[model samples]
Target: MSHKEALPKAAFQYGVKMADGRKTRRTGVGKRDDKAKLDRELQKINQIIARRKAEAADGGGVGTPDYKRPRY
Candidate 1:
């Protein structure tokens, strides 16, 4: 076969091999669990952001220093 014809055949075979590998890599339950964990982490991050915004609105957050008081 000519080089032009051989290259397409090799690429097609490689694509099929990769497709099969992806199918067997993860099961349905594992994918769902991963999604659930990611969702929980996202929710936690959003809650923290909201809390910080609320604190900032209320005249600065927890670690604001009092300028009127002397240091040490």
Candidate 2:
């Protein structure tokens, strides 16, 4: 299933940790938008995600990996 068709909300969040000990986050909302509008928002989110992925791959601002603690 396509993302837009599967997920009701188009908004998404992304975060990056700077090498200098700071964290940055990106988020958005299109809660009241119709399907077409939501699709556009999703496309925007996808594009931003792609760009961030490229930047991370290039080792731009992505610092050390963040490991998650295991649950008991």
Candidate 3:
């Protein structure tokens, strides 16, 4: 509640781009889907999954989100 602690806290991020592509951050997509794009997306997903798995194997698993928790 204090400004001191609140200042360090970041507000809710709306469109944050993670390791995944734009689909992971926002919905909808533009035209242009070909063999190259499909292969590119598959590669991206594979990379993300592999990275996450490696992180988990290293004793650092992904945190669980509390659905019941209120959003600011």
lDDT (0 to 1) per candidate: 0.72, 0.55, 0.56
Candidate 1 lDDT (Cα, whole model)? 0.72
Candidate 2, residues 1-72: lDDT per residue as tens digits? Answer: 556555333332222234444545323433534767878989999988888677668875455444532111
Candidate with maximal lDDT: 1
After aligning candidate 1 to the native by TM-score, how far in Å is the CA of 22 from where it should be?
A: 26
Regions more than 4 Å wrong, model 3: 1-33, 61-72
Which rank order by lDDT, best down to worst? 1, 3, 2
How do the candidates rank by TM-score, highest first? 1, 3, 2
Residues 1-72 of candidate 3 have per-residue lDDT tens digits of: 556544322332323334335455343443345666988989999988887677568755336455643222
Q: Candidate 3, clashing residue pairs?
A: none
Model 1 residue runs over 4 Å out of place are 1-27, 61-63, 66-72
Instruction: Give the best candidate by TM-score.
Output: 1
RMSD of each: 10.3, 25.5, 24.3
